[model samples]
Target: MTASWPPAPLSVDEPVGAPTLLPARAYVRAEVLAWERRHLFAGTWSCVGRVDELPAQHGVTVGDVPVLLTRDGDRTAAFANTCRHRGHELLPDGGSADGRVVVCPYHAWVYTLDGALRAAPRFRDVPGFSAADHGLVPLPVEVWHGWVFVNATGDAAPFTVHLGELAGLVAPYAPEKLKLAARHDYRVRANWKVIVENYQECYHCPRIHPELCAVSPPNSGHNYDLPGAWVGGAMDLREGAETMSLDGRSRGAFLPGVDRRRVLYLALFPDLLLSLHPDYVMTHRLRPLAPDTTRVECSWYVAEGVLDASYAERFWDRTNRQDWAACESVQRGLASPHFRPGPFAPNEDAVQRWVTLIRRAYLGTPPWEGQ
Candidate 1:
């Protein structure tokens, strides 16, 4: 099994070069909020909700925004789930139906599945109103396999195109076959950038995630890149660790179109991550709770019908708890008067790479376009 399931080579290893080191102060600055509004919340591809979570009448609340993601044949669509009139939320928190029309609770402003305004109450009397002009606003949504992503501002580059160099990084472990398993949410008394940087590298994993080190190789000990920008790098499973496929099949068993061979950890820009291992997959979304606080929600995934429940949850939950404790501690330390910026290890280049990219993008100087 080990011989057949060969691991692929890592991505390019050239240093990101000088004048590109990640700035430590960007994640929590009030000034950075404008950038997020311009680049991330409005520009980059962002996850909306899981595919499995979109069966019937389900919805996920992002800030004051309520988004409805639903399936139509093999495709999915997202709509701003708000009534065109009184601003009432359209669907109940979690419910589903096999129909195409959405009726608002307050005034029955019905909309087509494609988000066009279908009918409204008292239309004839509303002199200046036109249903065609008042349809539900559509968010820029793209579905890769079963994961759903949205670009809120309706102006981001095409989703796949924006993923750029990351496309091949996660090619080994198929993202489509993964399913949600377990979830844990954390409200941290820290800024959003701190959580992202903390997750960018495993340099502190040996000191922080001792148990996770037993399963996934620790990056600091190995020669893995720590991409400083919003980049995700993979770490191979320990040489002979116990492994299972998402379908409950042991390593090497194929699940139709999936490889099911190894593990992958995916970090999407701004605030989402997907950690795929041989045994299970984990998903995380970071919501800014405040200028000084952020909420981290995590969900684990397995193949469609497999149920290890407590066992799977325990393993990933332990890793998450460890991460939370470490990140919180780091947040507290950042308040200290003497902390300073530093250099990166030659081998631990992944986190540094991500930092550099993010800093450049936020400053409106993307990597591709020269300053």
Candidate 2:
């Protein structure tokens, strides 16, 4: 089985008008954290958790920063998950059923669901400061189709509009039907960019994913449609194409509204990667544990009411294992002294665009601005 996709190869010329290779070690600097907060985390929306997980009963922390997301009346609100007085962290892991008020474990400072200070353990003894002055810091949060997103910075472009035209790119994926399937966490020994770069291009697919390439005839083309962080590429459900797994269904089966289309991948900026086939969708989140190391979490989603346990597991397990194997191996190669920055292929323009957008946000310069 061969792919009907177009070939996209990058230029290999050196010392010309092209991107220079960045040092492999620069990803771990403390300065990068500040840059991420300001450039990446500040202005952009971040995937916090699944919409079902945001109820009052459960509280999840993103890294060491604890945050509380709960529904209030008809709306959802977010707080820094920290207490105002004594600066204690609130909501260790889980919260009460009501989650109406957050009480600091250390001093019993209480805050309303919306982060307003409601009471104190013993405020009568304190002077000058009042309950009104103490409240949980609010973090900007947004929800789209059951997915929860939060912006740590107080100031950011509205979530809906910040996405710009890119939102339209994913409109066809029917995000509303996407259901949580399976989640896998990975600790990788490479920069976060290494993992993202790996996902952004199919240049390595033919060499690393023989099973996937066999199933999706277009896997070798590397011609992907870049709708922001999401990638859409055609797959041949054409006759006789072997599948990644025997239990899996075709792409039309997963997304009922679509036609013969079979392949799609979407990455929620900074850290989330999600893809869909006919039977199920597998999503992954890559968290930067260190400059040189990252923790990756992948989840599978399927159509509601459809349960074939083995169907979802077999396909994702095989594909994910192959993906990680390739990424980890690439991480090892990045340490090589001979690994130089090469030119971008027309097919890889999406990766370059993603990198350009991120670098512009971080360094205030585009890849070809100086060239």
Candidate 3:
């Protein structure tokens, strides 16, 4: 199903004073998650990993569909990870390097890095068998600013088009020139949407994130509603604050041309979250494991050869744990039969936009109409 871009405006009669959140079932129902897996995840551009992570070969799941990334010479290619013979998974999840050929563990079907069927054990004996007709199915993959994003349906619009003006907003950081500095993964007991909603708004910042609020006031920012699938804005840092580290000081050199007084936060719907600071960029890629569980991979990037990242890492680790704890609490409450849709605060405009876009993608209706 094609998503309706720039979701239609909400109904005027829809109550904003106590604007209802997406129904509780949306967070804990198995059928609802399956619908999202088929429509939302399958049809959008979801980031998988960094370009450097797949220098050889890597296997990953975009939503629920397993895919493989291989570097063929100077180019990277993506294909369905299932072998054609019997639908067995070709490579293990998270990737591995066993040379140029990908050999299926079940039947030993060998495929070249470019996804060509190289050989199959005793397959020629079958009548009218042709390896040429059974090469791995290709998926659409685009590498933008050193990150790799893949679309399972292979029919979505170009990645840049989906990104809209976000590309220009973050151009000053020169993301392509930044190198990976540290990576951390967390498995949170929360729905993927819960995590996203928590990140999009800072309503809970002052109460939950003391250090973050000290450096960047929770009430000192405005939200921007960008076209396409992104929503974000810049938040001003405290008077003497250089960055969002534990001590309000920058841990490394400023990213080429970034402004030191403000930091940018963006929520790229369905999967990616970005935190752009003067000295570094932090990315969070969320993968849904179940209706109530998600796997979040957080990575930090900075100018090449800068090795000391403890300051930034420690601060974010503490902040992320706080966010995750809040999300988990919300998830538990959502499962209760008494839990109903609640009002959104004025500070949660970005969260409203996120909910609108996701509702459009999943139910083909705006949140107000559904309510």
Candidate 4:
């Protein structure tokens, strides 16, 4: 079925001169990265991975803080990966527990799948040591549309609350029923915010993404300043183009209930990037590793039972590499002493909004106010 060119109203108001990009220090300063680790990443709801990844128990690192994820009965739990006894890590990165209890490799301290302290080798002999008080420190964990999310500080708004209207905007895709098709990981030599800002705007599409611009013109869409953590909108595909594949063809049926001629892309602040197409969904989970380095994990999801995902995967794999290369170059440029903030194009309203959000989160003010 044919759809309108701009699927939704533009959230940004009348045209204004491009605002300046974030200062170079925001990308290269060690203190800036540390501030983000505490204020932005620690206090936000970050998409960790698919709930299926941790069938029993698994360990991961979020913004350098080791975390343990476990599936307990029908509920999922997240906790500090360190053992309370001696601060030793309980499980190795991505390591899984065989049964219900996760045992620390260092001292054999054991904890149940639900994060409750079950046993400590010799702690019972202590006069005042209490297993009840020494259970794994729990962090907030929630599952949305099959993806697991955790808040390191356990003080952010609920997952649904932070998502706001994004849940309804993507409801047509039925992401809840989609199954993981493939995954790829990349080590990008760029700041996490640089990567995020790049994804927030497509003004560079004509210069950097020839194949993408061929299927979806760089100037053919508008951005939405949606409420909550997400900022995105739909972009129309070229006439007769069925999907955003290398051949501009459809590899499978449209997602169960979504029949549209436009693709939706949303950057859920701090970590998750969601791209919704008629036939499949692509997500990028960003992990900030250092001031000038980031780890990106990308995954493709399609309706259950669809075997062939080569077209979409290859297309995006190429597109993602191009984006990462550009981001790394920008990171290098920002380090130059002569590099100064540049103006944002009218089409880059989303990037401006993203910068504003980051400033608000980290400095408690807008970027222009010297934050």
TM-scores vs. true structure, each candidate: 0.76, 0.81, 0.91, 0.90
In Å, residue 38's CA in model 1 sits off its true spot by: 5.1
Point out the higher-scoring one by lDDT: 1 or 3. 3
Compose the digit string of candidate 4's lDDT tens values, residues 1-371. 11111211112122356567777788888877776675466666778888866668888876657888888777899999999889998877778775778888889998888788899987779899888998999998888888888887766767766787778878888787988888999999999989889987888999989989888878777777555776777788999899999879978768866756888889886799999998999999998888899999999998877888988999999999999999999999999999978877888888877876665554353121222
lDDT by residue for model 1 (238-304), tens: 6555442222223322234433434555567767776656555667788776545787888766666
The residue pairs in collision within model 3 are: none
Candidate with maximal lDDT = 3
**TM-score of predicted structure 3:** 0.91
Clashing pairs in 4: none
For residues 1-371, what per-residue lDDT tens digits would candidate 3 score against the true structure? 33453322222233455656787778888877776765567667888777866757788877668888888666888898899889898877886785889888999999998889999899879999999998999988988887888877676666766777788877888888988888999999999999999988888998999999889989887888656677778899999999999899986888776788888999775688989999999999988989999999999998887888778999999999999999999999999989968878888988888776666655454221221
Better TM-score candidate (3, 4): 3
Candidate 1 C-alpha error for residue 77, in Å = 1.9
**Per-residue C-alpha lDDT of model 2 across residues 48-116, encoded as one tens digit per residue:** 767765666345455445667767665788777777887776766545356676677898877777778
lDDT of 4: 0.80
Order the candidates by lDDT, highest first. 3, 4, 1, 2
Question: Which ranges in model 1 have alpha carbons more than 4 Å from their true place?
Answer: 1-25, 34-38, 55-75, 81-100, 104-107, 125-130, 219-230, 244-262, 309-311, 366-371
Candidate maximizing TM-score:
3
